[model samples]
Target: MQPSKLRKRIGGEDDDGRHARFLQIGVPRGVLRCRRGPMDSANDSVEKKHRKVLSDLAWAMHKLPPKTYSLSVEDGAQDAFCDWAEAYWEKADQPTTKPLLAALYNKLPDHATKLSGTLHLVNEYDPDNSDQWHPSKTIPLSVIRLALAIIDCLVVEAERFHANTDDLEAQAIARFKELPPVEWTWDKFKAKCKDPIRKEGSKLWTNVVTAMRDAGIGEVTKSKPLTFRRHTDVDGHRKMSA
Candidate 1:
């Protein structure tokens, strides 16, 4: 049976859930039995062996959260994976041309680095710009990885949805539009958090913002300002002048 079909039959959450059960069942016994000819059964056995090996490899990589383990961007390994994918496409000799992949591989890192530097430069000149501008350098490697995974998921999903290149590009633009505005200063970001519009129901955006804040992209203020007002006594009453 296909992995998906097996999961459905076992009434699990997803393929990973089913695989977890398979692991518990023990590797040797978890080997899939096929109701087919000897040759087919042998092939199935070989495939099962490889699958078990992969499962062991995944376990050795550390116990990641379901989100991370999921074949999705929430895993936070998207950026590195994207780098690997670009290299894979360059090396792999598939029948179809991968010009788009080539273009992305060439453009993304340079674009990210340039945009990050520009935002940093602008921050030094104008505090206002610094508040709303998030440079790409502030993005964590894990988060970038997750973002890349999400991108991959969207592409695969688009193919499943019978979407064309234009549709895919449009979707990418839409996703980018949804990302939170970048802020170079913590104080500026804190001000943003106080804005009624920003504080509204955006959990993921809030989390990313918080992560950036934690990473020192946005630092919290520590000390109160000292007052230097002059105090004058008039008719036995002390009055403070700003």
Candidate 2:
């Protein structure tokens, strides 16, 4: 469960543009209007680029050995330089080799100030250039940290899914208990309720169904009336569906 690629559907053609119109007054400028206050965060084209980089990083992490994975680009470049020096420098004199080595070593960028430059140097040394020479652009530490945190969250969720499906079922039961007894569909429930469970976004239906099954609520049969029910005693042991 590496986070399901569940997409949400918007009703009309303006569905995609609706969010943009809400957050911005103009098209080209994309100026932040903040009609809905601080929650109306602005979206920019750079967000896609950042997402791609993080996806690449996560993919690379999956393939490589954890102990060998180096977040610091400079470290990888230094290792490459050492290997190159060992192989290429055969009969070079100490004076010539010393300066050559020093020059190569100095080329590694200062990590604290120039992370982008460090990544550039690493790209040059990498035969595969897996980052595709695009790391030259300065990416903020905040973005990188946020990406890592998301990855960590997904990995943890995956582990939990395997280990504690029962726990999730219990949680769903508990959440259902908090709400008034009602037949509910995810869409209707989310619109009417401000409960944290309903705000699960794209995976709301999946989660609700999973919890329903785990709690032995009922089977999901597809028909004209699409509904899920809470088996509560509120209406005298009667099942409620929505």
Candidate 3:
């Protein structure tokens, strides 16, 4: 059967990926357009261009393919991405709402993935076992390259199904890769990323606050305490863990 058309929804009720979420796979603005309302409507407002830029990053999270990037992503993963895009956009504070232009800018600089610089972007596998898993900040570039390759492959698959009817995942990928207006670069991956990358954190926080506020007079909110983890560091490697 033909791949099902990517569904397009609008207006997330402060829930996970809701509005326009189904189109998130690789459609432009699908991932970045999570913040609701006209002001956030397009993230193109003047005020939207005045936030901060995070200097470093560290990320770790496990995603079961079907759960991480597919239909149910809105249930969790999509919200996670939306949070990052929104948060990063505020920091990027640029006229456009796309966070990837800022988030991945440094990602492809010359020799960037090489062994240099104290600030590092590292990804670890088996994050639960100390012998097999734990956040590692100083892994060698050779190791990183392999990991990155795997990630690249996964990402390609992750967004493939979001391709248009006339487009196979490969065709879509190739077409989007060379989109005119300019040559492809880490900075201009905006087209390929399809939409603004979601801000990092807030969706869950917003839910919690909402729950607390809704409790009204004597809100007896009971849930795990929100824990804080720092993923950014100036003096050493900045890691990203989801």
Candidate 3 C-alpha error for residue 220, in Å: 65
Which candidate model has the greater lDDT, 1 or 2?
Answer: 2
lDDT per residue, candidate 1, 1-242, as tens digits?
53334434545233333222121111121237867645677888999987875565444323422221222244444456556567645643444634333333344443334333333333333333433433332434444444455445544442322213223333322332233533223333334343433333243233333333333333323323211111122221234579
TM-score of each: 0.21, 0.27, 0.20
Report, for every candidate in turn, its global Cα lDDT versus the true structure: 0.37, 0.42, 0.32
**lDDT accuracy of residue 133 in candidate 1:** 34
Best by lDDT: 2
The sequence of per-residue lDDT tens digits that candidate 3 reaches over residues 137-234 is 34444443443444344334433433222233233333332444322333333334433221212332333233323333112233344322111222
Looking at model 3, residue 230 earns an lDDT score of 17
Q: Candidate 2, residues 42-88: lDDT per residue as tens digits?
A: 45457766677667665653454323223344335444433433433
lDDT for position 239 in model 1: 41
Candidate with more favorable, higher TM-score: 1 or 2: 2
Q: What is the C-alpha RMSD of each candidate to the true structure, in Å?
A: 28.8, 20.9, 26.1
